[model samples]
Target: MDIEYIKDNYIFEKLNENHNLDDFECEIEDLAKFLKEDAWNQQNMNLSLTHVVICDGIVVGYVSILTDAMKLRILEDKETKDKICSKLNISENNVIPAIKIGRFAIDKRYAHNGLGKHVFRNVMLSILDISENIVGLRFITVDAYATAFGFYVEKHKFKYLKKDQKDVDSLNKIIKIDPERSFSLYKDIKSILK
Candidate 1:
C-alpha cells in the first residue's frame, strides 16, 4: 500500500470508493452535512489535512487531521481539552494544537491488507513533522468512532478521556460502544524529533 498526501480535489473525491462511511451506513449526504457544519475548519478551508492510501494507484483508504482550535473546541469539552493540554504540556496562553483523525475509511476490498496501520503511521509521521516546527503543539486528539476506538486504544495506545455522550448518541446510536471521548496518544513530538 502506498500512502500519499494529496491536496487535489480529485484525490479527495476518490475517497468514495469502498468508502469507510458506507461501512457505518453513512451516506454522502451525511458527509456533506458534517462537512458543512460539523467538520473542522482552518484558515477558511476545512481544517482537514488529508492522506490517501493507494493500492496500485487506486485510492483505498483515507485519513484526515483536524488542526483548528476553534473547531476542536466545538467538538470536545473543556475538561477533555484540558487533559489534552496537560499531555502536551502547553501553557493556557498558547494556542492548543491538536490532531483529530477522521474519515478513516478503508475500501471493503482492501480490508485485510494492513492499509489502516499504514495510513495511521503516515498520519503520525506528518503530525510529528509539523509539530517539530510549531511551538505550542500539546497533543494529538481524536474523537474516534466506536468501531474504531478499540483499534485506537489497543493498537494505537491513545488514552481515553471523558466521553461526549451527546455526540456519541447522535452518531452511533445502536453500536453501543462506549461513549466517544477525546484521547491523547502522542504527547511530546519535540523529544521524539530530537
Candidate 2:
C-alpha cells in the first residue's frame, strides 16, 4: 500500500454513533474487543476520547487518550524531583501531570504495514495540541504491553520509569496483569515534538 495515499485517505475522528465498532479486529483480542465493545461507551461517559482510523469507510485502527496523573517515580531522589519542579516552575507534588494513551491497536489485516506508527504520531501531535491549550501537562505516558515495549521504548524513545522492589510490588498489585512485563514509559511532550 502507498503510505501517502493511505495517510491522505484515512479518516481520523472521535468515536461517534455513525461509526460501527462491531467489526474491528486486531491480532490482540483484548485490544480489538475493547474498541469494538467498550470504546464508544467510554467515550460517551467522557472517560476517554477514542480516535478511530478509517479507510474507505472501514475502521482500520483506533487509539484512546485521557487526562491522567502519574507519580514522579522516574526521579528516584527527592533532590532530582525538586530540581525538575524548580525548572518547570511548579511546586513539587505527589502526582505529575500527564496525558495517557489508554488504548492503541490496529486491525489485524493492517498489521505490519506501518499504520501503527502513523497513528501514534498523530496521537502525539494531538497531545501536543492539547498541551498548548492546557497548562501543566508536560508528559505523555503509556503502559505498554510486553509485545509493544520495543515499539514504545526502542522505536519511540520513551523512557521507562525505573522502580525499586517496593514500587514494583505496588505496581504489580495495581496493574495485576503481566505486571512483570508491563512497561510504564513516558516522554516529555516538548521533547517529542523536538
Candidate 3:
C-alpha cells in the first residue's frame, strides 16, 4: 500500500507515522496543520490515504485521497457521463464510483517549482491504475480551493461539476462559517488511462 513515485527529483511515499510532518509548511495554514497533526490519525481510521513528496529526505509536500462514490448527476457534461458509464458498464442512473483528492499541498519553499503539477499527475496516475483493477472506479474528483481553481480546471483539465441552483444554495448555507470556498471538479478516469 506504499504508493511511491519519483518525479522532478522528489520521491513520493505514503505518509506514515515515521514521516516528519511537523516541518511541512504549505501556503495554506490549515492544510499544513492537517498533514502534520491529523493525517496519520485519519489514515489509521481508514478515512483517507495521504502521500508525501520527499526531497533529499525531507517531506516537502503531500496529497490525500479517499475512495468515494459520487451521484451520477455529479458529472457536468453528458459526454463525461457517457464515458464513465461505458467504463463501468452501468447505466447513467447508477451512482458512479470515484476517488477524491481530499487534500493536497506543497511546502512553501517548493512553490512555483512545478512540483505541484508533478505531484498531482502522480496522484491521478495512481488512481487510474487502481480503477483498472478495482472494477468500479470511473472518475477522479476534487473539491478545489478557490485559489487553486484554475490549476485544477485549466492546468489539470478537471471539469467543474455543474451545480444546480438548489445544490449551490445548500452548499452556501452550510459553508457560512469561515466561508471557505471551493468548487467541485471531476475528470473521467477513462480519459486519463487513455
Candidate 4:
C-alpha cells in the first residue's frame, strides 16, 4: 500500500459513509468498530479540520482537529477541561485554543508496515502547520488508547496528563498526549514534504 495524505471533503465523506470493519484485519476491525459507531460520529460532527491517510488511493485512517470553543468543552470532562485550559493559560470563559486528534485508525493489511506511525506523524505535522495559521493554538492533544499508552510514552515521548485508569475494565483506556513534550518526535516531519 502506498501512503498519501488526503484532504478532499468528498473523499472523506465517502470514506465515512462506506467504511466497513469486515474488510480489515481483526486488530483494525476493532478500531473501525469504534470509529464507525454513532456515538463517535455524533461527538465529532462539529470538527472543522480533517485529514485522511490513504493507502493505494483508498482511505484507511483519519485524524481531525476541532477549533470550536463550545464543542471543545462539550467533548472534554470537567477535570480534563480545567487541565487543558490551565495548561494553555486560558480562562474558563476564554476561547480555548486546542487541537484534538479525534480519530486514528490504520487498515489491518497496512498495519504491519508501520503505517500507524506514518499516519501519526502526518497528523502531527498537519496540526503544527495549522497551528501556525491559528494564533490561538497553544496545545495539541489526543485521547490515546490504553493499550497504546506505552507506545505513546516510551516510543513517542508523549507525557501523560493524568494517571492511567480503567473506566470499565475494558480494552479502552483514557489518556492524553501533550504535544509540547512530544515535539521532538516530529523532527522527521520537518524533513518530509507535505
How many clashes in each candidate?
2, 0, 0, 0
Off by over 4 Å in 1: 1-44, 69-95, 134-136, 163-194
User: Candidates ranked by TM-score, best first?
Assistant: 3, 2, 4, 1
How many clashing residue pairs, candidate 4?
0
Clashing pairs in 2: none
- lDDT by residue (1-194, candidate 3, tens digit) is 12233354687788877887767787768889889888899999999988888877888788888987778766777887777678768886787778899999988877766778878888888788888776567778888766676688778888877674354446545455433577888888877745
lDDT of 1 by residue, 1-194 (tens): 32232212113332332434323222233333343344334314655655545544555555656653422333234665566457767544455556556556565554545656655665667777777775456466666656565566666655553344454344355345444333333333333333
Best by TM-score: 3
CA lDDT of 1 in candidate 3? 13
Per residue, candidate 4 scores C-alpha lDDT tens digits across 28-99 of 344565555532465456534445455444656655555422323442245655775677676656654555
lDDT (Cα atoms) of all candidates against the true structure: 0.49, 0.77, 0.77, 0.47
Give the 10-residue window scoring lowest on summed lDDT in candidate 1. Answer: 1-10
**Candidates 3 and 4: which is better by TM-score?**
3
TM-score each candidate.
0.53, 0.81, 0.82, 0.55
lDDT of 2 by residue, 1-194 (tens): 45567777887888888987778887668898788788888988999999899888888889998888767646544554576677867665557789999889988877777888887888888788888986668778888876676678677877766573354445535445653356677877777766
Question: By TM-score, is 1 or 3 better?
Answer: 3
Model 2: per-residue Cα lDDT at residue 28: 69
Residue 50, model 1, lDDT? 50
List ranges where model 3 is wrong by over 4 Å: 1-7, 83-91, 164-179
